[model samples]
Target chain A: MTEAQEKNIPDVSSDFEPKIVAFCCHYCSYAAADLAGSMRLDYPTNIKILKIPCTGKVDVLYLLRAFEDGADGVIVAGCEEGTCHFINGNIKAKKKVKYTKKILDDIGLGGDRLEMYNLSAAMGQKFADLAKEMTERIKKLGPSPVNSGA
Target chain B: MIVGEQKPIEEISKMIAEYKTVLVMGCNTCIAVCHAGGEKEVGILASALRIKNKVEGREQNIEEASMERQCEREFVDELADKIKEADCVLSLACGVGPQTIVEFYPDTIVLPGINTTFYGMPKEQGFFVEFCGGCGNCVLDMTAGICPIVRCSKSMLNGPCGGSQEGRCEVNKDIDCGWQLIHDRLKAQGKLDFMDEILPPKDWSPARHGGPRKMVREDLKIDEKPEDEIEGITKEGEK
Candidate 1:
């Protein structure tokens, strides 16, 4: 497969440190990420966390803006379904992620660059795992064409 | 309101590729109301373009500004200084706004950031339904306020054609049959009798068919010269 074709999966190599923007919900994902930090889980350090009131607040425009602002990959970390503190915030975020994925695919950025993850605030290990997984995945994808040549 | 949608980012990026400096212009009127082109959209497009250009290592300098209205020459005049600094403009307004910009600054290339959709009204937030064709004829009186010319997928004035089933159009089950709506509305208002008035075919001359449309209201005209002209006249008088 061509480099572009093969770049869709996680490539855990030493030379890649993908820039990731994680839009974490305050009630769950943010706490989980914090817990992960306290636990000393050694995840990739490329993930930048932006805490939001709820996952539903992650608008599609914001996701696109993240990519536009040089983020190689984006993750909307919300509460697990049915466990959301804000009723349906996670569900709404899931829908937005799906919509954004379609948009990304259509725009030649590839849909896999954007992802949605769900975890409870106590699931610190999951948060760390997610961070590492996303970082590796994006590293495999190579630099976003939007940031590659630069 | 005229509803429009922004063109895809890739398409917009390609359109402005030749220019090193670009002004992303947004209209705050109809396009804004429709969530197509507005201050928010301008910022979004500007950021997208900047990132895309940066990724390509093209060194494009893009800036964003929004105007109250792009369709009017007076409103567009505010862009003079900003436009002068850019090699091209990416207009996020409806088709009318871009044309207005072109009229004022003939030398600059004005690119359309959005696809001009249709003359429509918002059905609800984020959704719009075409309601008028600007046909220059008032047929809504007979059809009970719903415009078949625009609402009907076929633009059939005397329709509900063979494609209408139950009360919906065959083209899309989601769409209500235009004539069905008209019939129901008229029936409820006791104006069903008007449907038999045998309305004649519409005259299209007043629309685009008759060379662009214009409105000259002698009553609204002021005898005094415009402000710009008055300023020039004052300078001449002082000299």
Candidate 2:
């Protein structure tokens, strides 16, 4: 935990800035991100948010398109369980995320790069933390193997 | 409806590896309802192949197309233009789809993306269970509408294969014994005496043992009658 030990740890290819696409539901996760911005919370800048009517509206095609277009990681963010603006939309989104993750794994894209999260609109700090976490995780994983050589 | 599952991505990718431009075709009927192959699934699969090719450093082109029902000639004809352009076709319908395409266009290579499993009905959302064997001679009438040919583990014609334990089949406890279902249904309908009528051994000729079979309905024939049939009809008219 010392500064000397932290300094000794080799950093991942520093020049490698991951491109993450996040599909955020307008009712919750999108508003949470907005609140984080207004609250002056700091988070990674690598994530590009695409606000959808609901996480249920986040089609598997969109997630695949992000990877096809060189996104290193993808996230589907929706309202917390039982609070989806469209009842059960978040649950459906979670199932879709799981299915899409399996597709990524089948196609050798590393399912770990895709994830689903749930949060209320008031959870600005949590939203910021997720962004920072996803960025760090993706950085450790390096570039998406699908487009790495391209 | 015919139910099928998509083949593994590895196998499908390998099948199209030699081809530069592969068309991924989907059927919007049975396979679509089962979520095996549909318009949406075609796009997903095409995208997956493109990503896989990129990862493997292969420059393969994958195209997507769909048909309302791949088994019919009219629906299969819709892909005439796309079929001519692609090096090969990867049909996501049941086994019939690719075969139909192969029959219509013998010069083109048609590959099956899904494995045709069985004639089944959706038991629930996302779950399909086999229900029919298409034995040519239907025995559902005598069996209280239950198909013992397919529903029974051993296809017993007379009764349960003496392996019926309680109401479940001996092959699997989860499966309800086919004979048991028949007995229950017949008993409920006051037709229990039908079970003791001693049915005869099925004529295997009508089944698949007769080789590939075709059903022709003279009443539904749209084309001209055969020469022999026409001559017979003319003689009858003259008489």
Candidate 3:
């Protein structure tokens, strides 16, 4: 209806292909993603997987960089609670995710763009499902304001 | 040690919006341990600011520098050249740190990037509690190391007033009763005799109530000449 509103609307004709980053922990989610491929499970190609030793290694800086570098949405998948390869890495990552989410809200980036989940090595189906779910969510939110210049 | 927390990125972004070039300075001593104004925090804040720049489609020079202890003159000196190059400085240290920098570089515009909170210690990982009031005089020995000036909700020298219930202060149910802690500690150490002794009223003048206090270590002076006699030397140093 308005120029500002028009700018925020994702271009549907060209098909908005949102770029998503999934920081997968080596002990669990990474293996699950690998298994997803072997099992011929379907997940959106929009998601780009980055292997990290532990989710605890994910810093607020890394998440900020992803969005700043044109990521429409970001996911941090680590081992389930109390089951981290490193004692409490996933718990620490959960806190960092919560912290970064608040930071995203502060910067007007919409905290909903970032999400965190706890997964195990055998949950290939769950991993693929979350990837598709996040892809759909980002598609609904449209391009990040950082990339859209809105 | 002084404890502090960095102000929100949005708040800091607003403070430096008018300046084209900013120097984000950090102090690594106490604030660093608290994960606030340390070298690592300086880098984080700088990166966040850069992201804001991209989001807003604006560009500015953001420089980062950190000192071992910004409150100390020796450490603050390391930032002098960097401070001179920037249009303004965003200081991520405690209250004393920004003042120390301003005292040296009188012409520079210094903006606070953090809020200096209190004289405190880490209660545990990621949590800090204020323990001291910096009252200039301490009553720790009489109270068995528990400070009534700060730890006590009312700073009551003879407390546990009707407000204390079940070892919790009335001010906040989560806070421990300062006098209750003192009483328990004194009883445990067999030092309850302190309770029998009527303590004298404290001298408030020794604290911040006296206004702008100074500590002089005459022995540490290089030249002990009085202020009036050093006119030529001091005048030159002022510039």
Give candidate 2 misplaced runs (Cα > 4 Å). Answer: A1-11, B225-239
* Docking quality band of candidate 3, CAPRI definitions: acceptable
What digit string (tens of lDDT, one per residue) describes model 2 on residues A1-150?
656336643247567788999999999999999999999999989989999999988888888888988999998999999998899989988888898899898887779999999999999999999999999999887777666553
Going through the candidates in the order shown, the clash numbers are: 1, 0, 0
- Candidate 3 per-residue lDDT, tens place, B141-177, comes to 8999999999998898877689999999888999999
lDDT of 2 by residue, B158-181 (tens): 887788999999899999899999
By DockQ rank, best first, the candidates go: 2, 3, 1
What level of docking quality does candidate 2 show? Answer: medium
Candidate 1 chain B lowest-lDDT run of ten: B230-239
Local error of candidate 1 at residue B2 (angstroms): 0.6
1 against 3, candidate with superior lDDT: 3
Model 2 interface DockQ: 0.54
For model 1, the docking class works out as: acceptable
Kindly give the stretch of ten consecutive residues in candidate 2 chain B with the minimal lDDT sum.
B230-239
Steric clash pairs (candidate 1): A146-B55
Candidate 3 on A1-150: residue-level lDDT in tens?
Answer: 666466666654448899999999999999999999999999999999999999999998898888878899999999999999899999999998999888877777778999999999999999999999999989888888778666
DockQ of each: 0.44, 0.54, 0.47
